[model samples]
Target: MTEALLELKDVYISYLGVEAVRGVSLRVTERDFVTVIGANGAGKSSVFNAISGLVKPAKGEIWFNGERIDRLTPPQIAGRGVIQVPEGRKIFPLLTVKENLMVGAFMQRDKKKIAENFENVYRLFPALKERPTAKGIRLSGGQQQMLAIGRAMMANPKMILLDEPSLGLSPIFCQQLSRQLKALHNEGKTLLLVEQNARMGLSLANYGYVLENGELRKEGTSAQLLNDDEVKRAYLGV
Candidate 1:
């Protein structure tokens, strides 16, 4: 079997005295698009936070490319090529569109590579290029979402963790973003996405996991879960 590019083993996390992620285990193989879907308080963001080193796992192991990373700092984790585009489009409100993207490449020193990455991100999201001088706060919701994704891409990550990529966009924008994510997958970017939109998440993902009350409730191929009656009733409203 191929080695997993990223793996979580019996991961647990807590805030104060409350456990947020309870013995969660998952894996992302190289270039695979995987998703975790759950209700509002099901610990999706906590899982991403632990993996990105924003919060250390209380009792489990996080491994990336065969190396243990649970004890690393956030910057250290990011430097190792695991990047996250957090929820709520956390762009610098005062920064220009171009500047916000440049922030994502801060760890790199190669000016030429940075410039190339900037150009590539602009090509991927021309709306950003057109408004390069605009402050991040001035962009629309959908544009901001695009900028968030573009910024993460600037890191040239081996795998990206995305939280709620379509949170507040219109239906059309959600579809468009989903297609872009699929394109990214085809181009060999491994992804671990957390989404509330179950249908869209499962449709785009190759493998899917369900989280409930901070624990893994189900796991399967996207197709299998999409058609499961319980999933449809709970997440799809069918």
Candidate 2:
């Protein structure tokens, strides 16, 4: 088995006397594309929040690349090469497309390296290159989502936490996003994706975890979960 690049052990998170995640343990192997699929309010985003250091866990541990990270600040975590593309495509609407991408490089000091990353991002999404001066608010929803992913990539992350990348996209756009995600995975980027679109998520991932009410209900190879009767009935509506 491949060594784990990211691991959570018996993690618990709470907010205002309510527990959002309860004793959840999971792992993502190096360079693996892993997906977490669950119903809304199942605490999937809460898990990502904790991973990104946006929410502190009340109990347990988070490990990345053999070091503990649960106590780190969000910027600290990003500095350690863990980045997130949050839900809702939270692009800076008032900023130009290039400026918004530049925000991702706040931690880096090497201007030349940052410029190289920007060029790579523009290469990946040529539409952004064509509209570098366009305000983010003027882009289509799909373009905004692309910008979000591109922004995260600009951080030079070792592992990216993606939350609902296909949430509001049409089928064609979702398919396009899935293809891009697969391409990233093929290039050996580790990914931990939380997605509501079970069919697409499972199809792209090598391993899959099912979360329900903040608890990890099941986990296995993607093919196993995809063929499982209970998983199909509950999540895939098969």
TM-score, per-candidate, Cα-based: 0.98, 0.97
Residue 233, model 2: lDDT of 96
Q: Model 1: clashing residue pairs?
A: none
**lDDT at position 230, candidate 1:** 93
In model 2, what are the clashing residue pairs, if there are any? none
RMSD of each: 0.9, 1.0
What's the lDDT for all of these models? 0.93, 0.92
Error of 2 at 88 (Å): 0.3
Local accuracy of candidate 2 as per-residue lDDT tens digits, 29-129: 88999999999999999999999899999999999999999999998999999999999999999999998999988877989989999988887778899
Superposition error at 48 for model 2 (Å): 0.5
